[model samples]
Target: MKISIITVCYNSEATIEKTLKSVESQSYPNVEYIVVDGNSKDNTVQLIQQYNSIITKWVSEPDKGLYDAMNKGIEMATGDLVGILNSDDTFYDEMVLQQVANFHKQNNIQASVGNITQHNEEGKTVRKYSAANWNPEKLRIGFMPAHPALFIKRELFDKYGKYALDFKIGADYELITRFFLKEKISWKYSEITTTAMLIGGVSSSGYESYKLITKEIAKALNRNNISFSYTKIFLRGFWKLVSFLKKK
Candidate 1:
């Protein structure tokens, strides 16, 4: 199945080239690449034009924000499967999509979630590599594969609707919660499909943003009838660090 990979970007000249090259260099050539930029005031647009041959479509203008840009990408996707690989991130290798497509064909799941690894600004692998096995029970406390590692059949959005526009930082979490928890959609796990990321996006840049994430996670769990305490979340967060130590 052809996959549409959407990238949401804003003033990402330094990194957008890497993201675009990663998409273009893929061994699986059927990717329909769409990039939605929020009016980057830099050479990001220039770089995009340089690689215009491989990109199926691209736009650079002001957008509501990350989620809004992503919504636009989803609206533009014409492939059978949809996935997001943000401007700040790149594929682990050229064969990553080929691996994901194989797993998709082998499993009966509507969505696929994979592993990830974080890297420094210089692209040195830093940390990350968690075993996020999907299940309704595991999800109660708080469980999610890396957002960048997720690939859903395009029809899932056609059926479930797009992400909630109200959420600021946690819209994706809410979408996953609704799709996997609220509606009980089946998902498949990819042991090493995508890299778990840590490129310090807007969400990871400050304490206030993290506080917002905590509040949102609590709100999400409350809606799902799962009681999560700060301590519980802290332990889970610590394991996130511990995850880097265990080599698979």
Candidate 2:
């Protein structure tokens, strides 16, 4: 099956090259790579243009925000499966997509989720995120599959819809909650790290963004008709803190 991977970016000249190289080096032959740039003021577009021959499609223009750029990339995807790889993240290895495709096709599933490692700008891993397995009920406690490590059948988006533009930070959480909890879609989880993410991403930028993400996640869960409380949110946050400390 052909898999289409989308990378969204803006003013990402420093890290875009690494992301592009990782996508380009994927061993999966039928992979389609698309890059959606938000009219970067930096040399990010010029750097992206250098790989024009390999990139399936690319566009550099102003977008409403990250989720909007992602929607544009998803709209351009023509493959059987679609995945989003943020500009600040790279695949764990060249075989990441190959494994995703093999496992997905072998099981005949609608979607796939894998593991991820959060790293510093120096490329040192800071925290690792992985679910023991796929559990829809875990949504009640703020657990979610690593967003960047997720690949869904293109038809799923056509059915459940894309990321909600209304959600500024936690749209991925909202979409995953909608799919697994509300719609009860079956997904295959591979115990493998698919993406190595840089830590200073949109949601994790600072204390204010973290608070906003937590609030947005609560909003997402509540809107999905899932019962979640501040207690559960803090319970989840406590474990994340423990994980970070243990990792450090």
Candidate 3:
């Protein structure tokens, strides 16, 4: 199956090269690479042009935000499967995509996700979300598969629709919840490392991080006909604390 790897970038010159190279080096041959740039004032567009031969399509234009750029990407994609690899992250290995394809064929799954490592610019591995034990229940309590770990069919986009633009940082999280939590989707978790994403993302370490997450979580729960309870939050918080201790 063809995999359309779309990357959304803006002022990402510093890291875009590595991201492109990672995709280009993939063992999977049936791949389409598309880049949606937010008219970056930096060298981001120029850097992309350097790989013009490999890049199936690329455009530099102004967009509303990250999710907006991503929607543009989803619109442009024409592959059997789709996966977004941001300008700042990369695959764990060249064979990652190839293996995902084979795994999907064997399991008859439309969506496949794996584990990921949150990292820094220097490539230091941060917290591994360790989504090996993922499920909707674990997700309701705040656990989620890393965005980069997902490889979904373009049909899923057409079926469930693109992300709602109301959210900023948590749009992807919300999209997954609405799709996976509300319906029976063909999905499987590959017990293997997939992506290494740069840590300290747009919302992770901000002063208003808690507030943003709180709003997103509340919205997600409300949409799914679920309710938030102090008990759930307390248990999840305690689970996080224990996760950290176990890591050490």
Candidate 4:
């Protein structure tokens, strides 16, 4: 089965090369590697040009934001399965896509979710996020499998919908919640570390981000008509702290 991997980036020169090389080195051959750039002012486009041979398609232009660029990439995908890899993240190993393909071939599911390790600039592991214990009910608490580690069927976007452009930080959460909880799509969890994410993304930065995401998450649940309480959402922080401490 063909797999399409999309990397959405902007001004990621310092880290984009590693992300590019990781995709280029994947053992899976039938990969449609697409990169969408938000008209970066840095040499990010130049770096993308250097890997033109490996990248199936790339576009550098202005976009609304991260989710908008991701929507553009999803529109360009022709493979059966689609995945998003952020500019600051890399697959855990060369076999990740191959494993994803194998898992889907054997499982008869619509989507696959895997684990992810978050690391600091020093390449030290900060926390490990796993989907092994994830359930649709967890959406009420703003808990989800790592977005970057999720490989989903492309047609699901057409059937359910694409990322909601209305959200600033909770679009991914909203989309996943819509599929797994609201729509009840079939999915399986694989115990593979798919993405190694670098810290300092917009959502991982600080207190203001946490507050914004919590509010947007609440908005997402309400929009989907899913019953939830701020008490449950705020409790997710304690779970996250537990996960981090376990990693330590």
Better of 2 and 4 by TM-score: 4
Off by more than 4 A, model 2: 242-248
Consecutive 10-residue window with the lowest summed lDDT within model 4: 199-208
Clashing pairs in 2: none
List of clashing residue pairs for candidate 4: none
**Segments of candidate 3 deviating more than 4 angstroms:** 246-248
Better of 3 and 4 by TM-score: 4
In order of lDDT, best first, we have 4, 2, 3, 1
Report the error of model 1 at residue 194, Å. Answer: 1.5
| Tens digits of per-residue lDDT for model 3, 97-145 | 8987888778888788788888877788867776777876665776678
RMSD, one per candidate, in order = 2.5, 1.9, 1.7, 1.4
What TM-score against the true fold does each predicted structure earn? 0.89, 0.94, 0.94, 0.96
Model 1 clashing residue pairs (backbone): 116-195, 116-196, 117-195, 117-196
- Choose 2 or 3, whichever is better by lDDT: 2
Better of 3 and 4 by lDDT: 4
For residues 95-160, could you state the per-residue lDDT of candidate 1 as single tens digits? 999999889889999888887788887778876655465565555555566788889988889898
Report how far off residue 54 is in candidate 4 (Å): 1.0
Error of 1 at 218 (Å): 2.5
Superposition error at 196 for model 3 (Å): 1.1
